[model samples]
Target chain A: MVKKKLIYLDNAATSFPKPEQVYQKMDHCMRNIGANPGRSGHRMAIKADEMVYNTRETIKKLFNISNSENIIFTSNATIALNLGIKGVLQKGDEVISSSIEHNSVFRPLMQLIKKGVRVKFIPCSEDGFLDPDDVEKAVTDKTKLIIVNHASNVTGNITPIKEIGKIAKRSGAIFFIDAAQTAGNISIDVKRDYIDMLACSGHKSLLGPQGTGILYVRPGIELNTIIEGGTGSSSESENQPELLPDKLESGTLNTVGIVGLGAGVDFILKTGLDKIRNRKVFLTIKLLKGLENLNGIKIYGPGDAGKIVPIVSFNINSIDPSEVGYLLDERFGIMTRVGLHCSPLAHKTIGSFPKGTVRVSLGYFNTEGDIDYLINSLKNILKTKA
Target chain B: MDKELKEECILVFQTTHRTLQAENILKKEKIKIKIVLKPRSITTDCGLAIRFNAEDKDVIFKIIKNNNLSLMGVYSRSGEKWIKL
Candidate 1:
């Protein structure tokens, strides 16, 4: 039997069909230049070491970071958040977060509460828009960190990160941004945004492979190291080196994955971030408009395509989201995500708790035909009660 | 011994990243250089050092200073001890 074509709309979860160069470079690095970076003095090790640095430089260019050493690699955004959150907050410290945060941020803040740390979760509007004023109102003298989700996973609503970052600055608190959803999809400059720390997944919009994530910390803000091991520097001292990356990054790096990430970033740079984002937004407008015209369909978040990322969440009248998702896949070979999307607070805020909305996320690779197919599929499902 | 001493200077940096960064900057400038393991006698943060011709010392120092790289020190070997240049 021939394989069915896949129309993947789960870019919010992880991008699919990465650029050809990503795959090619990863294979090349694995086959030929596979060596432990920063561990050996051999030629292959040096090559591997240079590959890692070059990837870091590419990421630095993408995010407009000044110092490449400040960027640390982790397994995923979750680990990066853990490192930043647990490393900064201590007993009696206060934190300010949002209601639309993913489990990565929500769970860590919850864990910190058990240790006497306080957190204020500013609620967003029903449409999933977080107000900068609400964040400013929650600030206190004890506030040590102010972290916000750059965009909602369920609603795809983009928050006013720059305004909120200024609030953190005035309050003398560290501003951390969880850019898991918007890192590569939108523009985020650490200097312009006054961001003290930012963490994001490389696999999502960045189009890198799994097991790659990034955390950028500003120069002055100090965080306790959560994990420490050999950084291939200052080997004489048993203690971890007191430096930028070596202080945070430990153990062998994912050379194959990092090299692939470099190629992915190179593709973005050559193609232009604005061009890639515009393509996604154009398709999203079509999807949102089509869903609005369909009977018995209620879209979530901002109905405006310009206000959100390339994601659409909606529900059919009285139909279970899981069933709709299943039929869309079983009958049409369309892939999507249903349920809370690991954001229970967002579900509750949008009044989709227990039952969640079907999220259709677009990627740079998606086309107009994919959107039309999805809309037709949903219409067919609603009409036939599939 | 005089000829050998005039030919090479070991440039050490604070971290492997700085060492590699220095290597990149110097390589682009067309400097004749080699990455070598740090000598046991020199105590530095990174385990690698760049070995270049002693004649290029003035230009190398200028480049290092302009780039703002964390240069730990420069050293040359004497009969038994490593002397700081």
Candidate 2:
């Protein structure tokens, strides 16, 4: 008898069945170093501080940020994006971004537009890669920030950050990247590419716990803190004392989440981002190779295989993206995420913004066998209709 | 062919990057120093600890600190271990 179980392919959303070490390490930290970090002078507090430091250090190595203090924690990528976008942006300053950004970048920039900040969107092709020349043309004297998504969640295409970063530098605009999709799966070098701010999700790619991510701000650039509360370092002052890490970080820290994030980074670092990315690319190539022959199924993004990440977005003809998602989950016992993916512009650029597409994002733990099973399931579904 | 040859010196910083930044800054100052990883005896941070003759340690540390830069443990090698000043 064949055992029927679920196969989760929505890693672009959140990873499930985290490594045993992630849960175990977080459990041990909670039991032992359960004190408030950066709050007290006690050993537990110090241990908590040390734990966060070690984790942030590991992340610095992961992202290749020369200074570990530059990695500031946020509740998530959305909050980090909001903090990075809204804090530095001022009235009348123009910000240029792409048409494929997630709501995390779009919503904040849109809010800035409402507040008198000018917003411009550079168009991306239907396949999802942006035209860097369009970005070059968009820059003007008023432009202060250039925000872009590292990879499209809708199409799994990568942006030419190095090329666009040069454009921003030429225009004297601060370049901010929403690295939610690429954080753990790809290697990011902040200095080599001249990146100003990088908003990351600890949970998604880094395999860290949710409610914990980082916003990497280059030193010497100051932004107003969005939320203010106790920062343990400078309690004696009434005003929020501006300092590295603590200046941008406010309120009670997510100590346990941060600790788990550290362990997760350790895992990512050991596995190596290049190896992880290659594995996902191999799986995506395998699935795409199998899928191309199937009738009634349409695929998106570059076919070179290397151009795409582990993510794959597709739809079956005569079926709604949501219904395709539903059938895959209910009838197939395979968990998948469907719909606009919160990027209307991405959909608009790809001509599926309103209707959306079914997204399958692979992660480090997934195997070729998993891809084979998914391919079989999809073949079975579309075969009946064919 | 006669560029001013300022003596190369080692500079320590509070932040992990300062020691290297010091070397770069010193290059502009026409002074040079070989920056190396800070010894674990100073701090567990991945910060750099450089080596040069003893003459430049005080001035380098003073310049690095005066700039409000990060410095962990700064010292010169007395054979093997980094002896902190």
Candidate 3:
């Protein structure tokens, strides 16, 4: 029996083959500095505490955040979004979002609707492009929060976040962004963008291990605590401490995962985010170009690669998306995602709802050869259908 | 014993995050400081504090103030007793 090499194309879900440093640092943290940070006075515990703070400082630099303490770590982006949304909004508050939000933002906002909160989902174009004007038009004085997904996980459509951020600032609404798909793939400056809150998945574009995510809360945003417990501070007080991170972060953090995240961000900083993003863009362009001439194949989203992230969604005529995904995996050893991509609203906007499209999400580690092979494999699949 | 430890003061913080942050900022300035357990008598938010020479008190306070750290207070060790400064 022969083993086949697997080609991973599901980076939008979670990045694979993280930077070598990520693995090395995680190993070093577990083996050497395996103490709960900030909980003990031992040397290892102090070292662990320093490592966690260093990661915070590194992330602060990556996002152009003013204060390192504003960045809070969570299990994943979903948790971060939950904290930001539930923490800030009150009854009768109007929150606006886009049609192309991942369930992370959409579901949370929807749940708020039942709590007497008004939730308006601004519709996007067929190509999943969100017009900033629509967002501005939806803004009301009652609008307390404007949350938008930085990029679509399904179509890879990049929203006009800076313009929307400006509108939120003018309206005095908190501008929150779900950077689940854009964080490390695209550069973001929380200050310049006028973003009051930003949530991102460390496992996705940040190239960290799973169970790591970040939420950046601007200074002066008095968010209510969603969950509270022991924070290793003010031990005598029965109430949670009113510190920046300790106020929100209430438990033993994922120290090992965070250490790996630090190394991953360091890799991005040293290699340069633009360089990493450009490489994926180059490969994505090649993949899109290859799919253009294929018969009976319908490509979705911004057909132009430059207009979106390194993700492509398409479908073969007369075939179910899951079947296509299965064939690609079982037959060609390629891994791709199909079906709604956990974003039914985005699927509806792109007219691929119910039976979604096969999605190929490229990563920095993916090569041109990999794209060519995918194209050839897709071609083969199409030929058999005919 | 080092002359610096002969007369020492502990800088306390509201959270361990600030304590570690101040340690980094002070260490970069080549200021002598040691992270000692929060004095058993001092009930502060954090379990740790920076023990430095009483002579470095002014400089340490300046650094903490410049960084906008949430410092609880400074305490000096007078013999076996820790007195709040």
**For candidate 2, lDDT tens digit of each residue in B26-53?**
5555544554544555544333445565
For TM-score, the strongest prediction is 3
lDDT of 2 at A322: 87
Better of 2 and 3 by lDDT: 3
What DockQ does model 3 achieve? 0.71
- In candidate 1 chain A, what residue range of length 10 has the lowest lDDT sum? A1-10
Docking quality class, candidate 1: acceptable
lDDT of 2 by residue, A169-236 (tens): 89999999998988887778887777999998889988888888899999888988888876654455
Residue range A29-148, candidate 3, lDDT tens digits: 999999988888889988999999999999998899988989999999999999999999988999999999998888888888999999999999999999999998999998999999
Clashing pairs in 3: A234-B45
Model 3 scores what on Cα lDDT? 0.90
Query: Residue by residue across B1-85, what tens digits does model 1's lDDT show?
Result: 3344355678987677778889999999988888877877786443678888888899999999898888888987767677898
DockQ of 1: 0.48
TM-score (chain A only) for the predictions, listed in order: 0.98, 0.97, 0.98
**DockQ values, each candidate:** 0.48, 0.04, 0.71
**lDDT (10s digit) by residue, model 3, range B1-85:** 3466768888888788888888999999889989988987888444789889888888878888787887888999878888999
Q: Give the runs in model 1 whose Cα sits over 4 Å from its true position.
A: A1-4, B1-6, B44-46, B79-81
